[model samples]
Structures are given as structure tokens and as C-alpha cells.
Target: MNFARTKEEQDRLEQIGELAVRFSERAGKIDEAGDFPYENMEDLKKAGYTTWTLDKEFGGKGISLYEFLLYQEKIAEGDGSTALAIGWHMGTMMDLSTRRPWNQNVWKEVVEKVKKGALINTAATEPQTGSPTRGGLPQTTAVFENGQWVINGRKTHTTLSPVLDFILVKAYIPQRKKVGIFLIPKETKGVSVEETWNTISMRGTGSHDLLLKDVRIDEKYFVETVDPVNNQSAGWLLHIPACYLGIAGAARNYALRFSTEYSPNSIEGTISDLPNIRHLIGQMELELLQARTFMYAIAEKWDRSESKVELQAALGAVKHVAVNASIRVVDAAMRIAGSKSLFFENPLQRYYRDIRAGLHNPPMDDAVIAMLAQKALDGIQN
Candidate 1:
């Protein structure tokens, strides 16, 4: 299958690359202020990036998964937080387009809104529930009443809520014995935002708590039952790895720059001249290549209509490799840079913090290890 980007997609990627460079320059300040990267998002929107994965039927470019991941990696290399935040939007759009059981009318309306630049996000995580895994079984519920659904619950880690036009909320329908997704408008009644995101890394992501007390949604906004297991492969699962990949790349680039410029008084030469420094850089490069190769391979496979079950296992492995590599790369950067890397003003510290967030993502270390062990045992039995 052809993996090369069409000329139009290539031009769009170049534009996104430019935006990423500018966003990177301001990322440190945004993290220090713990403010949302509104300006950066606007730039992304202007570049048609917000709709990068939207369906072509909806007047979007509808780029394949492989192309999308490549673009994500480039943007991430520029600014991890900005890429991390926007990744959710792209993933959300992909799910809405390809996975969520939306009817024709609902799809038409949502597609129209998306064409108008509406941003969607998943408000699935909660304070009581650590991750969306073990079932997104919400402490929240939506009751049907007066020709609409009334939603009530507190959702934590609702990333990008500040700028979201609509949120895809998971809530249980008591009478139906079903959990469904509701497209709740941000301006809906009883929807409130709580400034609860105080983190050492990815501060610019604006992952705050959402208090939904009697947030009403029209019946037309309800989508069909979402398969809990199948949701894992719907493109959004790639975002966590993409974020860490970007962070790892940034850390590697910084180390290279530091080695070439900084001259230690005792060494009597730049660190770049040292064999040890070159060795570390080589190791970092190897890890980056391995992680990226695994990620893009799965993406390419998916784009070619591969089986979801097999890809799910591969996705878990990719996350483990990418996140682990990110941690090692950042650690090496700090050690090579010495005391200067610890300063709050330096980007390395932020990379260190942001990479840790991947540890909390789904298909976590323990789960991935168990899955791999089970697969190995199954192979032995076979």
C-alpha cells in the first residue's frame, strides 16, 4: 500500500511543521504560567490541522492513520504539550467518524458542526476511576426526561475543556442497561469548569475537572451503545505514544545541542568531542528509532484494514516501548546537561515531567506485561 503523502497532504504537513516550531518557542512560557495554549491552538486551527483526520465526506482531508501518525510525530517534536493536547481532538474526531455508532442524521449534524471548526473531546476519566479502563462505568448517569437526557457527575482529566465546543460524555442509561455517549455542548446548562489541573508536566494541556450537574442534552445528540473493548483501537489510543515520542525527540535534540555548545572547565573541550557523549547520543537515537518504527508500523497496518485484536496487542507494546524510551532519553539529557538541566527555565525538566504522564495512560506497564506473558504461554501451548 502507498504510504507516501499526496502533494496536498505534504503542503499541509509543512504548514503544521511551521506552526509547531512557533508553538515550541512559547511552550516553556505556557507551562510556567500553567495557562492554556490558546494562541497555539488557533494557529493549528488556521492550518486545517484540527480536521486532519476528519472524514472526507465531511469536507476534510481524511488522511490515513500512517500519515496522521507521521504528522503527529513532527508536531510533537516541536512541542509535546501542544501536540499532546491537539492529539485528543484529532482522535476524538476519528472515533466520531469511524467508530461511534452514530446514525445518519446525527452524523450529518455533527459533520456540519465539525466543518464549522467545532472541537470535540472525550470526558471519560473521573477522580474515583484512575483510568478509563476497567470500564468507563461512570459514577455519572444520564436520565431521559422531557425529550432530553439530563446528565450529572464530575469528570476529572477533561483535557482541553476550556476550548472545546462539545464533549463526548459516557453515561449509563438506567432503564436501558446500556452505557451511551452523549454529545453535550459546552454551553449546556449546569456544565461548569473547575481549574484542577496542577501538574509538573504538560501543564499547558489544561486537563481540569468538569462538574456536570443536570447538564441536559437533546435526544438527538445521543449515540448508540459503544463497545467497551473495541474502543481501544479507534485511533485515539495512539495519542499517548505520540506525545511521549515527541518528548523523547525533543530531549534528544536538546542533548545534542548542549553537547556541541557547552564546554566544561575540566574537560578543556566541548562535550560533543567526548566519546561517552557520542555513545549516549547513539543510544538515544537507537531507542527513538525503535519506538517510532513500532508506532508507525502499527499505524500503517491499521490503515491497510488489519485486524483490530492483533493491532491492539501491538499498540500496547508500542506504548510501552515509546514511554520507556522517553523516560530514558530525558534522564540521559539531564545527566549530560548536569545542574543546568534542573532549572525550571530549561525545557528538559518539562520533558521529564510530561513523559511520566504516559505511565498513567491505558495499556499500562503491568497490563501490557501480563498480555505479553499470556501471548507467550499461548504460543508455547500451540
Candidate 2:
């Protein structure tokens, strides 16, 4: 597939790149203070990047999946935490906007809010269950009564919850085996944010727990579920690889810069001139190039058609490759940097910590391995 960006896409990428540089400079401070990257989000809002995934009909740029991933990779390269936090909203919007079967009026309202700078986040992960990966249904239930639904449950790992204007929550409808997504306003009664996230990695993401006690919403706010097999939802899966690829690129860049500039009195020249250091940089660059190719290939395929099974497998592979590659590249950077890389004062340590979180993200290793095995078995059966 031709991965070249169009003129318009190229222009927008440059603009987002400038913003990302500014965001990266502040990422360290926010990570040190363990505070949310509020300034970075505000910059995204001003740039209208918050609505990049929304439909043009709904007052958005309506960029393609390929372009979206490219932009995400650029932003993530600057600051993985900010990219991870902002990606949830953008990816969610892209999924909701592109997927059909939604009520027209409700869709319109949600899109308008997004256009007006309302950030949306996924409130799915819970305290008891890390993520809905191992057959665990949501304890969060939305009871239908009096022509409305009352949602009551606590959600953990609610990324960007502090500044989110609205949240898309997945809740179980009582007596039904199905799960429904509800659009809940942040200011709704009984909805509160708990500051529970204090992790060594991605500390600036502000992924806290959400307390939704008796939060009521009209029936129209519920997003009906379609058949998982038939439904097309590639945008959500693609964002993970996009974010991780950017991080890998960042690691490569950091290593390159350090090798070129830092010199020891014991050495005749900078580390970049050394054969061993140059070889490591080349290896990291090769990994990034290959991972990015796979990532964009899957994205372009999604743009062309809705193939959930194939897309899911491809996305799983991409995430697996990109994230693991990122970790390796960061580790290589740290190894090359030596003892100084271990200090909190160095940005390399932050990158090292942030890249590891990708391993725990959805489309986990075990699941991906099983899925790949199933594909192999099916191939043999045919």
C-alpha cells in the first residue's frame, strides 16, 4: 500500500508536529508533579485536534484512518502519556462516528459537543477487574426504568477523566446478556472522579477511577450494539499501534541525539562515531521502520473495507510488534546512555517507564497469541 500522505494530510501533520513539540517540553514537568497534562490538552483543543475524528457533517475535519494514525504517531513521539490520554477520546470518537446503527439525533448531539471542545473517554475498566479481557462482565449496570436508564457503578483506569466533558460508559443491561454503551455527561448527578492513579509509568495520564452512582440518562443516550462479527470497529484497535510506534520513534530519536552530542574524555569522539553505538541506532531504526509499515498497512485496509476478523488479527499483530519494538528500542537507548539513564532527571528513564505500559494495554499477549493460533488451525482445517 502507498503510505504517502496527501498535500492536505501533510499540512495537518506539520501543524500537529509543532504542537507536539510544545506538548513534549511540558510532559516531564507534569510527570514529575504527577499532574494531568492539562496544558497539552488545552493546546489540542485550541488546534481543533479534539474533533479530528468526528464526521465533517458534525463539524469535524473527518480525516481518514491512515491520516489519523500518522498524526497520532507524531504526537505520541513527543509525549507518550499525553498521547495515551488524548488517544482514548479521539479513538472513541472515531469509532462512534464511523459505526452505524446509532440514533441520528443522539449522534448529532454528541458530535456537536465534540466540535465545541468536549472531550470523551471510555469508562470501562473497573477496580475488581483490570479490563474486560477474561470473561468478566461489567459490574456497572444500567437499569431501564421510567423511560430512562440509571447507571450505577465504579470504573477504574478512566483515562483523561479529570478534564473530560463526557464519557462513554459500557454497562450491563439487567437480565440481558448484552452490554450497552451509554453517553454520560460528566456533570451528571452521582458521578464523581477519584484520584487513585499513582503509577511509576504514564503518571501524567491521570487515569483515575470514576464513581457513577445512580447517574440517570435518557434512553436515546444508549448506543445499541450490533453483531460483533458484522460490526466494523477498526479505529479503536489501530490507535494502540499508532501510539506505540510514535513512542518507539521517540526512543530512536533520543538515542540518536545523545549518541551525537555526548562525549566522554576517555573517548576520542562522540558515541555516535563509535561502531557499537551506530549499530544499535541502526537496529532501532530498522525495527521502527518495519513496525510503522505494518501499522499503516492495517490502517489503510480498515479505510478500504470493514473486515472485523481480519482487522482484529492484523491490529493485534501490529500492537504486539509496535509495543514490543518500542520497549526494545527504549531499553537499547537506556543501555547506551549508561547509569545516567536510570535517574528521574533524565527523560530517557521516563520513556523507559512509559513504554512498558503498552505491554498491558488491550489486545494483550496471550489473547493475540491465541488468536494467531486459531488462525493457523483454521488454515489447516481448510
- Per model, state how many residue pairs clash: 0, 0
TM-scores vs. true structure, each candidate = 0.94, 0.95
lDDT of 2 at 256: 83
Error of 2 at 184 (Å): 0.9
Number of the top candidate by TM-score? Answer: 2
Reference-based lDDT, residue 180, model 2 = 83
* Backbone clashes in model 1, listed as residue pairs: none
Q: 139-176, model 1: which lDDT tens digit per residue? A: 78889998989999999988898899888898778878
Candidate 2's TM-score reads 0.95
lDDT tens readout by residue for model 2, 74-129: 89988888888888889888877876557888777777788888898878888776
lDDT of each: 0.82, 0.83
